[model samples]
Target: MTRSATTPRPDAAPETAKTVSTGLIIVVLAFCGTLVSLQQTLVLPLLPDFPNILNTSSENASWLVTITLLTGAVGTPIVSRLADMFGKRLMLVVCLVSVIIGSALGSISDSLMLVIVARGLTGIGTSLVPVGISIMRDHLPSDRVGSGVALMSATLGIGGAVGMPLAGVIYQNFDWQALFLVSGGFAVVMLVLVMLVVPESTVKTKGRFDYTGAVLLSIALTCFLLAVSKAGTWGFMDRKTVSLLVIAALVLCAWVPLQLRQGQPLVDIRTSLRRTVLLTNTASVLIGLAMFANFLTSAQQVQMPAETGYGFGLSVIETGLVMLPSGILMVAMSPVAAWLIRVHGPRIVLIGGAVVMALGFVLRAFLHGSVLEVMVASGITSLGTALAFAAMPTLIMRSVPITETASANGLNTLVRALGTSSASAMVAAIFAAMSMDGMPAVPRWEAYQLVFWIGAAASLIGALIAAFIARPQTIAEALRVPGEVVATERHEVKRPEAENEVVVGGVVTDERDRPIKQAVVTVLQTDGRHVDWGRTDNAGRYTLALPSAGRYLVVVSADGWGPMSGLEDLGDADLDQIRMNRRLLLTGHITDHGDPLPQVMLSLIRHSGEYVATTHADTEGGYEIGLPPPGRYVLTVVDHPTGRTRSRAVQIGSTSATLDLDIVTGIPRPRRQPTEDVPVR
Candidate 1:
């Protein structure tokens, strides 16, 4: 693949496209994360009216929130596994598109069932935050990874905090449908931005889609979440709840063994067993429960009738304002979490976050006097939630292989969602059991205090679990400043006298046996001293001039490929048997409205439903992307100016090919041909 200086290289990666700033990338991902989470609470303020609008009972109307929780919990792990197998960006966009379509459907729907279904579709967006975090780890440089992941993780709190107030304002001034309309619009914007900015992950665990595992998991989670959600309404010991729990338990018993035997399980049982992953996930579930407790209780605390003594009697909009500080704190604390993680490791951060959450709950339990106190307490819990969330992903990344990062995080997110679901159920059940003595509809201040205490206990348990999580070497490395000196550094003898600069190196290739040009190959002497290093060229070949070529450990690494190391006994003769495998790459082009689209953004998406790469169209409308060979990809052309975009799924092979994109309009844009103006209706 090497080219002569005089020859024109085929699609030489545009100089402008060489390196994108990590800051911009994280900002896009954080926005997407915020949008995804914002959908969760967008319908919060509109729930009461559902009974009237859809002509359904209050219980039936509550399904608007319930269905979303169920879907997010059940769909997250499934979508995550897909992301791990295919592409993270692709799945993220798919999740967002589902939200857009679902929002669009609900915006016009009069049927209660249809609205519930639309809300369920919106729930899929919850998984995007995890997938985005995984994408950050894959694409962001090492130095930027912590902060990028921190911001992405914090969006969950940020979006949830913002959603309620925003929805409240819209409900007051506009139709309820306006919420869905606005949500759909935001999702569309997020979709375009993600496709433009994020790159698809090259690392993937290739295998057949696990339909059985996916189905079993969906069934198990649905049963479990459904049961938890209905505990307050149906009674904890009701037949329906008992039956659902039984079904979940039985299905899980069978599912665990089934995954253990699968060639490629949906939730990799082996990786999940790792102490770090296990404890981190355990903490995730507990902290998720504690974190969501604040969300469910804060508004009620502010909106209670003044007769209750603890009630501020604020409107929904006013309650939202009171909770605004909580969201602000979450956003503000994310950088602090990132700093702590960089300096002290994610394990410590997880534990610290849990402790902070417990403190927040404890503080609220003891200081429930005024609106200011309530807001301050809520802010503390939000800060803690931000930290815990920010650490969970980092812990998962360190525990699992790069190939499994997305799925693992997805599974972790699923666990957190389950916890959040539990929080909802727990809060409802507690309030239902301990209501105002005279008025059955309201709960006393003491009841709220009890919930706070329970949240504190849950967080304390999370902190305990996080403290037990194993510390991975990667975290250890990250905790130390890059230039810090190690007092225990091993000493090695200088071997300059035994020099034999006869190049003893070979090329690196991907799993498909194609040369992976420009990969870094390093050689260290048997005594553990860094001897030499170099990079592969256009042909994925590297030549290392070793010193005295005794047995040495060689390590090879590329951006998209997994890091590989092996022992090699290099000598003067016959030194050409080194090769490495990496993920595949593909390339393409794009055009706009009937002409070349210069500077337009394009996303190379896999048909399995994940994004692979983001590239810009050249001055002549030419663009290129990288992907694994022998799979399908959807080339997306994003024309921001016209908002007329195109997405067509296409298949490709081992070698690169030409695929030009055309402008498309899902929502009609102004046509080039002039049309007669119509009279206003």
Candidate 2:
């Protein structure tokens, strides 16, 4: 799995001994890192020009930026996992290539669709920051790792801060194509540096690809993000929006069970759920939202007219000039943040950074009229962002296993992107709601002030979450242990041994009394304790160990077969034989039947219980329900086209054995009327 880059061994000497200089490597990688965030903000000023250039509506042109953000949000975690599985250097180079190609395509494109596609391609490059940061740790000396990480981390915000004014300059002096050409030049430079100085790390793991988890997660994320991003454009309560939301929910429901069952998951759901990782990610999201307020307010304020009673009325170049100081402040503050982490510790630094960011927002809320006020506010906010961004990686690295450092960091980055995307959508919605007569008429001052107030509230919440995170301390200091700090609090719970034993027998069948495999048998006490459990062998036989002797309820469950339950006295015989009856056989055909209904999925549920199952009827409309346990069940059939559904309750075992269903026809009648004797045989 090794790539061409230098693979540093864990016990090997620091990268300083290598022929290449450590400082040179940092600069090279940092420049490459700059391309990602740069792409995001560089397009902001050009958004106004999209409609005329592409002959598309303003809303359609807006997707150029929104699509890039959405793609980056989805791509970061996926690419991070790939980086770990393959090689960091390889992934980094691949990302740079994408940026180069995307920028080239965008530079020459005349159609709005092609430019949007190019922006998405460039976003794939935007996902490389976390991967680059993780690789830096592997190659840099321990002494340099802290500062190196700080610089790399700050690049996320720094690029955006710097890109704004740069974009304005390019947009004013040249065509919009110049922005793409400039980014393409940056990418070309990074490609050269990546090949020469950046060394690869040896941290690797062995596992098969978790393709199932990846696909399901992607679908869930795409659906969910589309719904959220479109909420502002389409009414939130719109039916299409609600339908996408529902689909997203269902896909997520399926994803959880699938991930838990897989041995090697894409994102470590278990570890990510722990208090340390969980709190850090939560704080990251809030901080991301707070940090994004800077971009929203600054970009709009600079371009707005001073006559609007709130804008500084700065030209594009002037706005870039206004933002220049904040970028400088951010870079300057990175090393200081690194030093603070070494002394006062990361937890305190993170909390302090959050509080400071909150204050910056409040300052913006009160004083955001003149260029001076905006500049001061930008500096304050960027400084806080630099501090918080620097501390997060240290916390995550300390919390997660060494093997998952890059992947965990990637997920942390994704959370931040999620928060930013959410903020973008919220800002769009607020502006849209406040506007009148198709123009932004809301007092420019109030609009900026409201955004700052929102940011302040978000930062305050981040501060509170950071306060609850356990501060990093030596194991001996925290638990009185001798050598190291052990993660005792976040340890997984061990399963308890059985306290008692029991055996049960069941006759499994597939409607014709044929035996079934993998049937699950269990005994549940009244107190919610599982007294005994076992899986049925090929012969439909099972045994279980009881937790204690008591009156318990026995249940048998199998996939495709209905569940069976009964009372059992474990203190007595502890042995029981259960028979499962073939409930209802709701067989139906799926076809146009004069009108075409394609890809129809049928769902069935037991009237008295939560037993449910789904199946897709073939084009011929032919479908059958396997052996259902004896009970009253509700059967529902649905077609995607009309969303038309038909439902009815039919008693199994007692009613006629054969029941036919039709989608277009009226509900089928029960074979035996209420006055007739329902067959119980």
Strongest candidate by lDDT:
1
Q: Each prediction's TM-score against the native? A: 0.71, 0.68
The 0-to-1 C-alpha lDDT of every candidate, in the order given, reads 0.75, 0.70
User: Clash pairs of candidate 2?
Assistant: 165-320, 475-485, 500-546, 589-621, 590-621, 590-622, 654-679
Per residue, candidate 2 scores C-alpha lDDT tens digits across 1-681 of 011212332223344346677788778777766788899888887777889989999889988987887677677777888877666888888899989999999999989889999999998886677888777656665456667878887776668777877887787789889989999999998998888877665454335667887787777777777777788888789887788889878987988877655545678776687787899999999999888877777767777776667776777667777777777787788799877876566777889999889989988877765788878987798888889988888788666544456788888988888788788777877777665344654434556667788888898899899999885343221211111122333331212222222222334445565666556666555544333344444555443433334566777666544466666665445243444564435565554454434568777788976767788777666666663666778877787778788776767663334445666674463443121311112
lDDT tens string, model 1, 395-513? 88765655567888988989888898999999988888899888887987788988999999999999998888765342222222112121111221212333222344455666566
Q: Which segments of candidate 2 are over 4 A away from where they belong?
A: 1-16, 436-444, 476-681
lDDT at position 341, candidate 1: 77
Q: Which 10-residue window of candidate 2 scores lowest in summed lDDT?
A: 476-485
Compare the candidates by TM-score and give the number of the best one: 1
